[model samples]
Target: MTTDTLVMPSVTAPPHSHRLRQVLHDSGYALLSLPVGVLFFVVVVTGLAAGIGTVVIWVGLAVLALTLLAARGSATLERAQLPTVLGRPVPRPAYLPGEGGPVRRLLTPLRDPQSWLDALHAVLRLPLAVLAFSVTVTFWAIALGGITYGLWDWALPQEGNEDLFELLGFDGGTSLRIVGYTLIGLLAAAVLPFAVRAVAVLQAQLGRVLLTSRAATQAELGRLSRGRDAAVAAEAVALRRLERDIHDGPQQHLVRLGMDLSRAQRQLDRDPSAARTTLAGAGVLAREALEELRALSRGIAPPVLADRGLAAVLAALAARSPVPVELAVDLPGERLAPATENTAYFVVSEALANVAKHSGADVCRVEVGLVGDVLRVVVEDDGTGGAVLVPGHGLAGLADRLRAVDGVLTVDNPRGGPTRTVAELPWA
Candidate 1:
């Protein structure tokens, strides 16, 4: 990674789908529902207290306390559900670490802004529930009552003895009576849907605003946190890889080359042909050492990947992979933001490398495509399948690399076979 690009490990799972929208709305409704239930329970308990006569005031205060207790629990449940339903990762309220006293824990939630907002949201729920109930229940009652009056004239007993027919200047029969009820029914029918719909609209807006975090803000926070972690992980991996390369690869080759040179020097006094053979072996060792050094350099972030962009780099990687690899690049020819390009390159490279070394696959497929506003890369190999992400391994390193760029990797290592690694990179 370049000095300008900071790599960090992040939690970059994509948000849940549209199916979660209904889940969130229902959760909001549930959060808002507690106040009405509390209200009902309080009213009943207060009425019971009135029957007892002496303890009505004390009982009312007790009911109030119970309602608040219910509200607090409701808020806690709402906070927990918001992450799953809304796909917003809000931290839960934590108790004070050492002191487990009631006063300290109560003060802790009061001090947190998120907890306060949640409490405020819970408090707002009661009035909203009342308003929603009034609008919905009242409209239905009026509409159904009007319909009943129109259809069943006997149900309008108050209008029976009245000269409503004469008041409308009509014969005192069914027609005048029918028309009055019919007109009321029609008016009520039209207004009812409008009223119910209006309430639902307003409630949805209010609840959505109070409950869900904006997707963009959540994404940015996730990106930054993941980036920091991946950076640390990547730095550590790079250092370890460099150390291994020096110790096992180039250092061994250099040692052999030195031994070869020493042998050739001793043979030069007596047997010129033997000395020539040893010199040839030393030359081959020097070439092998050079190749190992080149491989080490390539491992450290390839210069071609930086200069030519991810498409070209990936195309080259596919060409060189051990298996007959099918490379498909849907990325634009133009370069992306450098960090994003690097992360994508590392993912594809590591995936393909795994295929070559471990996966006994004949052919590997690598795809890079842009879906919606995000870039997706998938690499699949039809090989014996049991790929585990051990710590400090290549795939793990690649996972960390993708995280730095607000991307994620999903690996499928089913017991049956064929491991598939899919990576998603956000365009921004």
Candidate 2:
């Protein structure tokens, strides 16, 4: 009989190995908080004292302002360090700038709430750091000492000393005592990683709360309000433009068609030949009216855009443009949302129209691509560069349109030549 030997597959470590590494990293971060906290506390305290003490002399006010500025700088440094522990970007808060001359600027930090918040963080970090440092050092010392107790225990004078196992109520026999102490060491080692992580997380959270600025929320709210206003204005302008286009083009053609047909009806009985010519003229007017209507509709939403997407639509636009256009469009295989596509189309259309009208350039380049979750479009031309986003100008309307969709439009046109217009929209 032949015996078959089975080979076992090697087992790999689980996903928790990453967590173990993170805990180790966080432990080092926690330990570092001790020195950073102490240094920050001392600096802020000294500054505050000197500033307050000298305030009656007017120089104190300047000192106090500088102190607050220093506090803000320290908070910024701490903010930079957070990504290692938190694994995400922490946005810096905006500072309110003082207007006018150097004196106003010097005093600006004093009035800023974020600077005061930074000062508060500096003051509070000391106690938190002490707690974190104590936990880390105590756990590590106990764990390492107990883990290697067998080597060091014999070096200690054995006359009056009771072993750790005896103190812990374990039996004092040599073999059992050694096993018990080692078990305690093993338990400490296992708990050390978790303890370090917890303390580090707590300290990081405390810094985040105290150091980060609250002004970001306020700024966003203000931007949203302005965007809403811009949207309403843009919609009003679009409606007026649509009304004007209909009145100027299709409305006039329809009126002329009606007039021609009426005249043809009158001449049919008296002069049949004349009536035929008039009727032909009426047919021509009818066709013109129909063509104008189609063009207007196309301006609103091109049918080809819906069917084939942006690439095909842009190619058509390039072909139709008065000046030569170098077009490069790179989009994903799947279609984007209808709103995104429409906004992008209109922005490019308007920008190109402006370029053809105003920029006396022989050739222009249009580029469109996706950058992460943003859609970026750039239109550049060699033109007499005096483009400005003033009210009543095309660029102003373009800016409003972009703002409505949480996008932005920027124009760069120096006096000599070369105009560049960039529009960015969020893809998702």
Candidate 3:
């Protein structure tokens, strides 16, 4: 079977009412852009010209600074209006931080590249806004006029007039006239949505490129950097937890095993019976230590996961869980990306470990399935709930692990009841 696309799926047509509503929104944005754009253009251009004409005077410096400030205000307002067209919040661009003396602070805007870009956008958007407004108004008039032709057609005097049909070598009958106008209206109406959408997109895209593109890129980079940092922190926490567990569990058991063997050796000459009993206890201790090590080792990368697949590894986990586990997996026959499978395995392992250790529940449920381009892993337990993602805690580590690969984690656990952990990962 083929895999589905994992990001930015193809756009599909919405319901008619929704489409019409969106068209109205687009029209409103189009109508508003012209006035807003013109205002910005006039303010920035006038200020810049006046400032340049008098730059020799010290007053020119202040004029230029204030002009940049006016441009920024216009840009901010436009940014706020952008969501109507873009359907996403526009992030404010980071300006140069003001520092040092009053003169230095006043001059900060001149040095900032974003401020210049903002000013440039203010000057350029006026033409685009005019174009969009012209197209939108013209099409809207044609569509509305033609669609309502029948209602208003009889009001016009037709007694001595040669209609357009007559000029075109056809009968100038009223019925034909109305029909023709209505058909023209219908044609314009058919193209109205696309026209509005095009204008809105044009305006929104230009605003985005000029205003927020760089800031958005920087934000994304910051997010990735944070995720990487979280991954490193999670690794550190996991290693520490592993070390503590080993020291407490297997290390202690090994010490006991060693002491048992030593005691048995001393008892062998005094009493063979006691020596045999001590040896038996030592055998049990060895077995327990081996099992504890194996259990801890499973959380790390297990070879069976790579050798067999996710299903086999999940089955093994279910079989070995301390709390009875109910596992359900719905996946394609082929293997997923190694990173995806590894994360899923770790999620299940960690979640189950939490349930067994803290949940006090009789049973836990684990489910893994592919939904569109996302892999969803869910673990639910019917016990005392109140699960939280405290920093340095297991849940937080799990969250970091998921975030490292652009995944998300959510937990739903109220005070007194069941706990649910859900992780969504991009299907690589």
Better of 1 and 3 by lDDT: 3
TM-score of candidate 2 versus the correct structure, residues matched by position: 0.58
Candidate 2: stretches off by over 4 Å: 1-16, 49-56, 96-99, 213-248, 251-403, 406-428
Model 2 Cα lDDT, one tens digit per residue, 308-397: 998888888889889899999999999987877877888788778878888898899999999999999998988786678887556787
How does model 1 fare in lDDT?
Answer: 0.66
What is candidate 3's local distance difference test score? 0.86
- RMSD (CA, Å), each prediction: 9.9, 13.0, 6.4
Model 1 pairs whose backbones collide: 7-231, 8-227, 8-228, 8-230, 8-231, 9-226, 9-229, 9-230, 10-226
| Model 3 per-residue lDDT tens digits across residues 41-153 | 99899989998899998777788888999989978877887786777787776788999999999988888878887898899888879988998898899999999989998
Highest lDDT scorer: 3
- Give the higher-lDDT candidate: 2 or 3: 3
Clashing pairs in 2: none
Better of 1 and 2 by lDDT: 2
The 10-residue segment with the lowest total lDDT in model 1? 1-10
Misplaced by over 4 Å in model 3 are 1-32, 46-65, 87-91, 94-101, 136-197, 254-288, 382-388, 414-416
Candidate 1 ranges beyond 4 A from true positions: 1-71, 74-103, 122-130, 151-174, 186-194, 211-227, 255-282, 382-386, 413-417
Best by TM-score: 3
Q: Which ten residues in a row have the lowest lDDT in candidate 3?
A: 1-10
